[model samples]
Target: MKCILFVFGIIALLLCATVQAVDKSACSQPHEIGPCRKADPKFFYNSEKKACEDFLYGGCKGNDNRFDTKEECEKTCL
Candidate 1:
């Protein structure tokens, strides 16, 4: 029983390590421009600005536009 538990623990550790490696590769890269607001309420990709821009501006009276994922936002914007 003890041996079986030990093996299971090792396998779990290995699986966790593999998952970490994959996540590291996926989230390792950095973004350039960062998050920006292109539209108000709803946000979309802004290729030219390099930063997310608000959908609405100038006293529109709405939630501030921002990207949830900084890296993604920067990557798309920048």
Candidate 2:
């Protein structure tokens, strides 16, 4: 049981590390407006354009790629 618990702990640590990495690397992600129906303006880094672009946020369920302002997006992702 102790060995199994140790393995589980290691797996949990790995998962946490992966999540943290993804969060930190949000700038690389594509724009995701998500699946809601509210029109809120937002900015996201466009990797292909190598610039921040504006998009209409649905106000929910979007990824961390979103920023409230163009300056903030440029600061974070550019």
Candidate 3:
């Protein structure tokens, strides 16, 4: 009985490890328009354009493709 319980516990742990929570917005293309900084330089990964494009944030509209650098955006999204 003890051995069976231990195996079950291990299985539960493994299952938990396999499950990962992903942000749909971040991965999705077609960014939003608000909640960004204009002066703050950033790179956004455009899935449709299939490239990291430089954008001037309106300080109130943008999507989850926000990145600090173009390379960083490609590394993560591309």
TM-score per candidate, in order? 0.38, 0.68, 0.53
Candidate 3 local distance difference test against the native: 0.67
Estimate, for each residue in 39-62, the C-alpha lDDT of model 3 and write its tens digit. 666777777777888766666656
**Model 2 residue 24 CA deviation in Å:** 5.0
lDDT of 2 by residue, 4-78 (tens): 999999999999988767655999877888999798999999999889899999988988999999998887766
- Output the TM-score of candidate 3: 0.53
Among these predicted structures, which one has the highest TM-score? 2
Give the top-scoring candidate (lDDT). 2
* Tens-place lDDT digits, model 1, residues 1-78: 999999999999999988756544422233223344443233434444544543332233332233455565444344
Worst 10 residues of 1 by lDDT: 26-35
Residue-level lDDT for 27 in candidate 1: 29
Q: Candidate 3 at 39: error in angstroms? A: 3.2
Taking every candidate in turn, the Cα RMSD to the unseen true structure, in Å, is: 10.3, 5.5, 4.9
